[model samples]
Target: MVSSPSATPASALSAHAITAHMGPCAILHDIHLALAPGRWTSIVGPNGAGKSTLLRVLAGLQSCTGSVQLLGRALADWPRRERARTLSWLGQNESAADDLTVYDVAMLGRLPHQAWLAPPSSADHAAVEQALRATQAWDWRTRALGQLSGGERQRVLLARALAVQAQVLLMDEPLANLDPPHQADWLLLVRELVARGHTVVSVLHEVSFALQADDVAVLAAGRLRHHGSTQDAASHRALEQVFDQRIAITQAAGMWLALPRLERPAAPAPSAAAPVSA
Candidate 1:
């Protein structure tokens, strides 16, 4: 489930000896992560590396053997509403009702703050408006979800998550279906959130974008290979090794860029001309 908008205390979250499994198959192993307070961190790894699973564990949406702490309290000890206020999640490939308007979907984020069967308060409207605008979806507020293109629908879903206004935001592949310009907008929004002292954690497939975060958690084969500031030489080395050294991190335009290192195909063997008739 995607998290609703919320306003909770800005605090650090961490895990101790966390392990997760699905039936007989283990998905994560003794994972430990300490997220920086009031900053942006990204979890990046190859497919099937447990990146999304780890994010779910941190959000308390998945069961695990280890313990998780939120704002200095056991995650399980917090009331559901309190947890909702503290964490806002944006998941990959989220779906909404085709008949629902963009405004209706985004308003869901305000549910945690509204009374049962009650109308949206002034603050609720303000938050939704702000989120929609930030995601550049305000122009289609009244449009039905079914009418929008894939990228537009993605924006509406993001607006819904943003409306929650939670202190700890966790997103999985927030840039899916977005063009380069909107992807840039998403990054800027992340920067704005961090600037306002909010903590953001994301699982990104785009390594270059992930490198821009304040801190990084690099995972490989379901284990934490490295966790530190992105600028650290150790982080870059870990990132390269995780991808089997198929990419090299370099400085370009004053920012770190992940450039793929492709090996040229061997020259084709000389063709053997046998008894071919013209």
Candidate 2:
């Protein structure tokens, strides 16, 4: 189900013959993919399958052997500041200074839009407020990042990414430390982004959540196994095969869920008859 570049000239993002190496080990093989505009795509795979690596390459934050196009133009050709303005990235467990206020942390996303040594504009403040509210972290705007719980920190970081207001967002393990309700909130946020014609690419370990994306990209051993609509049979087969069929994809409550295919624990052996008689 690999998407052909020829079919999508105006893709939001496209990679061709991408290969990445970490030291002497090749982490990602040749991968060709094109992600549609105004859509959400989730990358899912087993550990060490290069999901994060692929995302880094897409963000132009990692060195790879192939070319990536952003908005139909060569990624490498874009100026650094311009590229930063066009793409926002949220990495797993991203760290910020503990003493920085939540609002200050989110303001970091506005750097690309500001001139050298210039102060944040009114628009910058507005964007940060909107982003913080979107993540439900506005009430803690004045609080230090260190004072918050892990989930709270995650939401603030998400706010920072959103404040960039980029055309495309690349998030890796964005759901880390989030509770179920917050995770559901993230789902709704992504939908809102897509509806506005923004492109979102996320690496999600939660397969059920991944299925909620418009498309799924399943990888294995650093190779692209499949990239297609979430409802496509081929995509489902690839998912099942990649995880060794230890999970079953089923429909429940009008949404897809990837349930584990494990047998119930065997009942404990009955106590000795002598103990019962006593």
Candidate 3:
């Protein structure tokens, strides 16, 4: 049900001096970001680092200071339906009604393009089917949401987002609950989206997975620590620092890998303790 915007040469999404506050605490602070067309950008940071808040702002779900632009136009200027059609969002812990079938839930992605009382059209059906197949969820189309396992449900949600077919996608922890194989599948789907000129921005806790992205943004204490290519030294350092230096980044098989460091054994207590007791 998502509608494509008129072709534009500008970036898919941009945020300038974005700041969000929750009562006495600030969730985001003066953040600036942009997602180029046909590219993948991963937001990586420690827990409570405001990555999720930034995604919410980009999705137009959270109010904040500063401006967000979609396809060169101010985000606030777009009609709700138009904006929804142009930008699709997959939140960190999205849940669907337990009684709804997978097919029915995926069909909701078309809501932005549907008339108030209009039933699903042939195009909608085709889009939903393609999306489900893309995410390998077509086989479970008729299953109730509650019947699926955690990973299965996550795939279904991804299918729902894909069905929107928006030019820009913002996903928060899309790999949540996914097995390694399914996670690989999700990565492939993202690459396909970018190949077709779609822009993607994802917040990921998996440092290794984030390394696969075309670019990475690291956040700390509600501020941007680094925003650049994954190969950039600053990005690597920020990523390492955010993780408390517990992870080591290395190139293996020409691919960047973030491996956790083995804990070092503690040194034996000094023999002087025995003499002190005597």
How many times do residue backbones clash in model 3?
Answer: 1
What are the per-residue Cα lDDT tens digits for candidate 2 across 1-278?
A: 01224544578999999999999999999999999888999999999999999999999989999899998999999999988888999998899999999999999999999999999999999999999999999999999999999999999999999999998999999999999999999999999998887899999999999999999999999999999999888888899999988888989999888999896546799877764563
Model 1: lDDT to the true structure: 0.89
| Model 2 CA lDDT for position 215 | 100
User: What's the TM-score of each model vs. the native?
Assistant: 0.91, 0.91, 0.91
Clashing pairs in 3: 1-110
Best-matching candidate per lDDT: 2
The parts of candidate 1 lying over 4 Å away from their true place are 1-11, 264-278
**Candidates' C-alpha lDDT:** 0.89, 0.94, 0.90
Candidate number that wins on TM-score, 1 or 2: 2
For 1-278, candidate 3 gives per-residue lDDT tens digits of: 22355676477788999999988899999998877777999999988999999999988899999999988889999999988888999997899999999999999999997999999999899999999999899999999999999999999999999988898899999999999999999999998888887889999999999999999989988999888898877778888888888788888988788999888646688775454563
Kindly report which residue pairs in candidate 2 clash with one another: none
Candidate 1's residue-wise lDDT over 1-278, tens digit each? 22323654334789889999988888999998888678899999888999999999999988899999876678899888777877888888889899999999999998888888999999999999999999999999999999999999989999998899887899989999999999999999999988887789999999999999989999988899899999999999999999878889999999998999997546789988899799
lDDT of 1 at 251: 91
Least well predicted 10-residue stretch by lDDT in candidate 1: 1-10
